[model samples]
Target: MKLPIYLDYNATTPVDKQVLDCLLPFFSENFGNAASRSHLYGWTAQEAVETARQQVADLIGAETKEIVFTSGATESNNLIIKGLFESSFPLKRHIITAETEHKAVLDVCKHLEKLGAEVSYLKPDNVGNITLEQVQKATREDTFLITVMFANNEIGTIQPIQAIGAWAKEKNICFHTDATQALGKISVNVNEMNIDALSLSGHKLYAPKGVGALYLKKKSPATHLMAQMDGGKHERGFRSGTLNVAGIVGLGKACELARNSLLFENQKLSVLRDKLEQGILQNVSNTQVNGNPTNRLPNLTNISFGGVDGENLLMSFRDIAVSSGSACTSASVEPSYVLKSIGLSDELAYASIRFSLGKYTTEAEIDFTIKYVREVVEALR
Candidate 1:
């Protein structure tokens, strides 16, 4: 087994070997400017990009033309939120989202708030869930968009996306979800969920980094957004930039693999995750699990130890690579806002650890982590 077991799949995933193989040719042999419309090289690259777009669309139940590639989920979130805000500012500027959202969504909302957008940041329940009732209560006549995360990145709590999406659709409001952590870990069908726009990242699902896609629903009254990146007017004039063919190919292959293996992988990961969670709770004193116990990603468990410093616990785990919180906000000394929002005290929040499993995780690794975590917590106490 590897010495340092990686239980932080939420931070990012190692690119799958199959995805790597699919993308390698684009880096050299098949390298071409996808925008070069008059040459064979351009044609090949464009074909690969379109195929990737289809793969991405297939995973989310979106139309092929609805998939707009971006740098990653952050860019996708910015494009959708900022784009929508830019398109409808001063007319319908109210937006609704949750407090537990990823920084990508929260930060974009905050940025928009400075420019006359009224955003309602709803707080989640103790289990890290934002009920459809909360969203309904927060709605207003001017609410143009309701953007919430499909799942909590830190705690792995899945939200009521379908319920909220249906409400938004009924009210003629655009609904967007940052599904970076939820996609591939769970089933996400945009049409069934009534989602108008959704954001996803490649690295979150065993694809290369710096590649993601936004699913913008196409209908009679199309979801409109101003172009965030102004350039050659690519991606149907929504985003304009030279495409990352290799990363896009990798993302497409990863999505295809995830679609095929999601069920088996979820079953496998849930078992290992449960074993790890139960083992630690049984062996360690004063340990409490975070997030919705039943409605969360299958492969993740966040637990807070009662009497250990979070930093010390992390530093002691020499053979385990876990996370204290979201990788995006790990540099800050503040305890996870996600845990705190879910009603954990400061000490408990600080001592919390997130163990996120993945397809490559094995039973042996889970066993080792269980024992190692018990020993470390016991010794720290």
Candidate 2:
């Protein structure tokens, strides 16, 4: 193991070479503002942007016009949350979001609260899942929005977006899902799911970083989004400023490949994940698996090693790439808000390890990772 075996796909994925191959020409010869209308370069870039938009739309059963490209998931999340408030909806002046939403969602809601909207933060079940009953009880007549993630990036649990979205639709509430982790890993049908809006990131799906999109439901005055950024009329005026043509093109290509081969990719990665999880539990002492094992993304596994510090474990695997579920706070170590919300103690949270598999993982890599992990944990003991 001369190089660290990269298993942090949930954090970010490597750009697919084939996607990069598609992106290379656009950087040099094809470079132009997709917004420009005067020249062949601009037309070429604009055409590519439209093609990529279609690719992204095809991934999640959205119309190309419904997809608004932005800087990344954070921007997408911000746009959706803020735009909902800025809209003319007769729904609940109250917003409902989960405690376990990405910081992007949580922080935005907090800010919105300061600006005078009431928000209810739903707590998930112990397995990191928000129940339909919980959501049903949370919705109010003025509930203008319901935002939840399609998957937990850290724990890898897939949320029931379709069920939640259906609940929102029945109440005429706008449903927005931060689907950054779900877009390429699993099937996302916005129509079938009854989702009003969804957010996604390019880096999460083997596309280059710094690019993402939000799916806006069409003709649905259910959502009236004011432009978040002021610039030339771009991204259908919801999001302004010129597009990052190269990154957007790369993102689109990545979406096309991921969409075409999703099932096969999930199956392959899940096998590697199961191997890693089984090996650790079989060989290690006092290790507890985190999250709902069955309802999680097939590419992820998080475990808590009793009596071992997470940083020590990560350092020991200086030869491996992984993350602790705990974040360091100024006064004390704060366990992952997601895990803590799901009821893990500080010690257990601090001891947690997350191994996320990805597009290029192999059985050989899993076997080697298992071997090294066992040795490291045993030595730590």
Candidate 3:
């Protein structure tokens, strides 16, 4: 077994061997600009990109043309929020989102607020869920979009996406979700969920970094947005940039694998995750699990240990990899905003740890982690 057992799959995942194999040829022998239409190389690259596009679309139940490639979820979020706001600035400026959304969504809303957009940030319930009623209350006559995350990255709380999507549809508003954490771990059908636009990142689901896709529904209230990037008008004029063929290929292959094995992988992960959570709780004193116990991602658990310093607890785990909060906000000394929003005090929030499993996780690793965590917490106290 590896010395340091990885329990930080929420931060990012290592590219799968199969995905890597599929993408490697694009970096060397098949290296070609996807835009160059006239040449054999360009045609080959374009064909590969199309194949990847189809793979991505298949995973999310979106049409081929609806998937727009981007650098990652951050860019996808930016393109959706900024593009929508830019296209309909003063007339429809209001957006409703949750307080526990990722920084990508929150920060974009903050930026838009400065540019005359009115955003209502709804607080979540104790279990890290923002109810459909909260969203309904936050909506306005001019509300053009309601963007929320499909799941909480820190606490592993799954939101009421279908409910929100249904409500948003009745209001003729664009409903978008940042499904970076939820995409491959759970089933996500855009049509069934009534989602108009959705963002996803490749690295979150065992694909190469620097590649992601935005799904913008074609009909049933087609989403119209201004292009964020100016050059060469790629991705159906929604995003403009030279395609990362290798990364895109990797992302596509990863999505295909995830689609094929999602149910089995999730079942395996859930069993291991529950064992880890139960073991730690049974062995360690004064520990409480965070997030919705039943409605969360099958592979993750967030727990707060009373009377242990967060930094000391994290530092003591020499042979285990875990996280206190979202990787994007780990540098900040402040306690997790997600935890705080869900009503955890500063001290409790600080001592919290997130253990996220993945396809590669094993029962042995879970056993090791449970024992290691108990020993560390006991020593710290």
Candidate 3 lDDT, tens digit per residue, 1-381? 898999999999999999999999999999999999999999999999999999999999999999999999999999999999997779989999999999999999999999999999999989998999999998899998999999889999999999999999999999999999998899999999999999999999999989999999997433688888998988878888899999999999999999999999989989999999999999999999999998999999999999998778777888998898423344667788999999999888888999999999989999888888988888898
Q: Score residue 56 of candidate 2 by CA lDDT.
A: 95
**Candidate 1, 254-302: lDDT as tens digits:** 9999999989998898999999999999988899999999899998999
Residue pairs in steric clash, candidate 2? Answer: 91-142, 92-142, 92-143, 93-142
Off by over 4 Å in 3: 220-222, 326-332
Q: Model 2 over residues 4-31: C-alpha lDDT tens digits?
A: 8898899999999999999988999999
Compute the lDDT for candidate 1: 0.91
**lDDT (0 to 1) per candidate:** 0.91, 0.88, 0.92
Residue 157 alpha-carbon offset, candidate 3, angstroms: 0.7
- What is the alpha-carbon lDDT of model 3 when measured against the actual structure? 0.92
Worst 10 residues of 3 by lDDT: 325-334
